[model samples]
Target: MKAKLGPAKGKVSDLAQQHGDKIQHGLDRAAKAVDEKTKGKYSDRIQSGTGKAKDAMERLAHQEGTGPGPGAGPDAGGGTPNGPRPPVS
Candidate 1:
């Protein structure tokens, strides 16, 4: 399964790199609409999830210095090419 996902990951990463900002804007818009519809009942959870999603997207896109570097390894809590995911901070 992991091997099969490699190509998909690369494709997704490429797409994310090209459309990260648009994707983030869409996420924000969706979260805001959901919050308004729910009367802020789930605002905090929605915001938190959105933040995490954006972070993951950035990582996947290799943006904002998320690419391999100091302090970026299997222990970085970001998924590797074919390694276990560390717990999210």
Candidate 2:
């Protein structure tokens, strides 16, 4: 069970690194669309969920790295070692 998950987690982590920006962008866009459609009724909840999802993605991508990438630290919400965090579409 655990052994099977190890490789799967690794692959997912790799994909996260390869597509982190795109993934984040998609999440942000989806959240924004939902919020707009709901006229802010669920804005807080949407933002909270978005943050968690982005955090998870970052954690997965940076699992083997030294620190939290973007969305963290003094320089969070700016750029990461990989590159500038892409603008939310």
Candidate 3:
């Protein structure tokens, strides 16, 4: 049982790492698109928010081994009982 579980756990870890990278890449691309569409007018704010979102996502990926649990920072608003709410006003 232990021998069989080792490979399965390794595969799951690899998949999670790949998925996390893909998600972060997608977020970067989306941020770039938004900046381009706005002609760089709101570039600073967009980049800031994008950074935060990426961080949150990475944190979530890291927390996967801990079972289902809250995955957001304290300032991430506790209003939503499901998951992290949007970091916007």
Cα lDDT listed for each candidate: 0.72, 0.74, 0.63
- How many steric overlaps does candidate 2 have? 0
lDDT of 3 by residue, 23-53 (tens): 7677888888888889889987997888677
Residue 38 of model 3: what lDDT?
92
**Per-residue lDDT of 82 in model 1:** 43
| Model 2 / residue 31 / CA error / Å | 0.3
Better of 1 and 2 by TM-score: 2
Tens-digit per-residue lDDT, 2-71, candidate 1: 7777677778878988998899888888888888898889877888788778778877887333234676
Best by TM-score: 2
The sequence of per-residue lDDT tens digits that candidate 2 reaches over residues 1-89 is: 87767777778888998999899989999998998899889887888788778877987886643334556766443223543333333
Ranking of all candidate structures by their lDDT, best first? 2, 1, 3
Q: List the residue pairs that clash in candidate 1.
A: none
Q: Which regions of candidate 1 deviate over 4 angstroms?
A: 63-89
Per-residue error (Å), model 2, residue 40: 0.8
Better of 1 and 3 by lDDT: 1
lDDT of 2 at 63: 60
Q: Against the hidden true structure, what lDDT does model 1 obtain?
A: 0.72
